[model samples]
Target: MSEKVTVLVAGSWGTALASVLADNGLQVTVWARSEEQVAEMNQQHTNTKYLPDAVLSTQITATSDLAAAMDGTKAVVIVAPSKAMRQVCSDLKPYYHPDMLCIHATKGFETKTLKRMSTVISEELGCLESDVVVLSGPSHAEEVVKRLPTTVVVASHNAKAAAAAQSLFMNEDYFRVYTNLDLVGVELAGALKNIIALGAGMVDGLGFGDNAKAALLTRGLAEMVRVGSEMGANPLTFSGLAGIGDLMVTASSQHSRNWRAGYMLGQGKSLDEVMASMNMVVEGIRTTEAARDISLKYNVQMPIAEQLYHVLFEQSDPRTAVETLMGRNPKNEMEVMKLETWQQWHS
Candidate 1:
């Protein structure tokens, strides 16, 4: 019998990850609230609404019953959106038990509490925060579902749990997984990049050239490093896959919902219009909101994020936001970050 692994929720990312686990010879059980959706996946082996283009593996199954889904599972992959994470984990609390490796693939933080996904999972499940592994990187579900070459990082303070996740998801042919010990950096980088992606999209929407987008990404990364460093993360983590790599893909890719939403906003659509048009959850929108709170709390200067927040919430014009960013006081580009965490590495 194949080892059982449960994936909570049936969104695009969750369903895509389910395919990966099934490909690894695990019995992938997905828990979704919709019974009709569950029946379709179990009977037809496809998730038409989320992943209409790809056919899911036969080894994968779906259920509406949480207890049945979690039963006898060796690992649980939490892929719910940031908004629903706390409640989803709370619902799973009854089924959570020791020795079942808990890994969360959600990228954004809880908007109300500002807690990381892993922390939210641990609190709800009553496990040590370190026990929950964070799975993140440049990989997008649209590409990963098609078995395209994708790399992701599984991070945790628990080396053993991280290695278990890497072993469970790593596929030499298409899916590659690496383990990291820096949990904060991994999670923060994954979440913070979305804010920049929103900015990138707005820049594109405003007809800003490649030079503008490239500069946004580079400076956005600097902001990420600065805040992440202040929050006790290794500043170098932003230089790794979960940082620059993910930022590059999310900010520039046509498949990114955040980028698409920002593009519409830049083209002069309101947030309401963009939200209505986007049938899917744009994680970047919520992440942008959370980033604003984080920047204020950390006392960090995140000009792009602040401007994007204003454009997104305060109804500031996208073009005006761009102009504001461009008109900021000049600084030494190389010495601007003032990052002390990474500086200690050289000394």
Candidate 2:
């Protein structure tokens, strides 16, 4: 009866979630790549580099040894960045077993293969893609570590896996977890919204009024639903927490790395300078590229994402990108939403 829970990587989100599990009275182990981070988490009971304000629970420990961290754990939470996901999962492959419930909080796609995080994890773990659960929403690690009220979703094609994830992270007071069977929808919503958040930040950085941001969010959601539905995701999921809810928070908050990075970009900084200053992975940079490819593959119209790709990669001016988007031929909003019907939700 191995009930041990382990969180791979000691990043902000991973440490924050480890805190939740530790608070729940579960013995949690956080695996770190740096021995110094591991020693800091174990000795100082603080992860000052990532989470400076809070002290970690004694129930949680960390290790640099991959095998030692993963040994005999029934539940494993992988929170590596998208760029490191495959390699991290590959590193975990030998220690992986069929019985482990692999729940991943990593958002964004593997741009190289244009595969979802679940697809990457399942391939490395030799498990069904449905066996990997995706945890996402507007939850920021900074607030989540402070025990602030936050809600998120855990989606999997496997009901029991989703249920187990719901049970593992749901906090009665501060953190709320919802279960969704639409794995595709949850992943896409979580990944795609970052691109919109980047645009929202650029709007703010450009000193555009709320009117512009509101329009961006509204239309951004439409684009999210448009691409998601094309990829076999339910349109209604966009209306829920993973979609609009996550979009609002990411777009508005300074705590969001993507938004902050975009703000720098809008302030006339080069992409390299923005990346160098953030000292963190701004997921939108990579996601914008991945989403562009996804849209082209699906043959869907994603004007916003398209412009963002150019602005980010092609060195197109931010103002010019906005103008390009504004100049596009108009189509009726509803006419574009070819879902079964938007009327069903209102009925």
Candidate 3:
């Protein structure tokens, strides 16, 4: 099985996952947009620009050619940023096999359609929902590549697809991949958590104490459940790996680019300024917009998401948005539980 699997990853996260699979004795190929990174990974066995200090397996092959990298792959893990996903998939569509399992690790929604990464894969590859799987959780690329203790979840409506994806990444030493049946909840939790992580980063950057960060995380989870539940997702999924797990890692970890973007915003940098300087993708910026639209479409109130959206696009002051969140209408904890009213929860 190890010798049969091939992977398609474009960035550090993809490269890291490929390396992990390679370490597990699977044949992995990483597709990099830059020839330099590909050459470095192929010749030196290191992706110094992205995963510096982490050595890749000799079995792992890196290439700049997308079709060549994707050739004969059993599973293709689309790991590029959300904005680039469409174009990448478009280029590979002509070569995609119907039987190939399309997996995505990108934790973001498309800016134009607010579509999840899996949706983009399905649309581009002309595959059914069952043919797509999403693998996401608290695992960060930098840490996972270092063999750090990390857990992640693979979700798909098709149980067999989920199980196959789980087998691809699960390892006793480094990555412990779990399986879930709630594709909507898992993908939503993974994508929306980045917005909360950005807010958390802003709170910390403003020199706020843990109390403030804690409040943000808690409220953020409530908002996530609200939006996700309205979209026919299992609310309990928010408490699991792809939800709370992702939130914890993205909001607090230094490796998180979205958190860093918010932190810079708190420190008085403009959105454009921060975006221009950061080389990595701050998924929250785009997710914030999509979340704002989602909140309105579902008639859900996501104050935190709204505030972040204003700060990000509407040019509202971050400090002012924080004040707004702090002084919102007071309500009991059960106020959030009401959001699940649209659909009855038997459990």
Best by TM-score: 1
Q: Which candidate would rank higher by TM-score, 1 or 3?
A: 1
Model 1, residue 288: displacement in angstroms?
Answer: 1.1
Give residue 182's error in model 2 in angstroms: 0.4
TM-score of each: 0.98, 0.96, 0.96
lDDT of each: 0.91, 0.90, 0.86
The per-residue C-alpha lDDT of model 3 at residue 36 equals 85
TM-score of 1: 0.98
Per-prediction count of colliding residue pairs?
A: 0, 0, 0
Clashing residue pairs in candidate 2 (N, C-alpha, C atoms within 3 angstroms) = none
lDDT of 3 by residue, 55-173 (tens): 88898988878778777788788887889888988988887888877788888898888788888888888888766889889988898888999999999999989998888888999
Query: What is the model-wide C-alpha lDDT for candidate 3?
Result: 0.86
In candidate 2, which residue ranges exceed 4 Å CA deviation? 339-347
Poorly placed runs, candidate 1 (over 4 Å): 335-339, 345-347
Ranking by lDDT: 1, 2, 3
Lowest lDDT sum, 10 consecutive residues, model 2, at 337-346
lDDT for model 2, please: 0.90
Which portions of model 3 show Cα errors greater than 4 Å? 1-4, 337-343
Question: TM-score-based ranking, best first?
Answer: 1, 2, 3
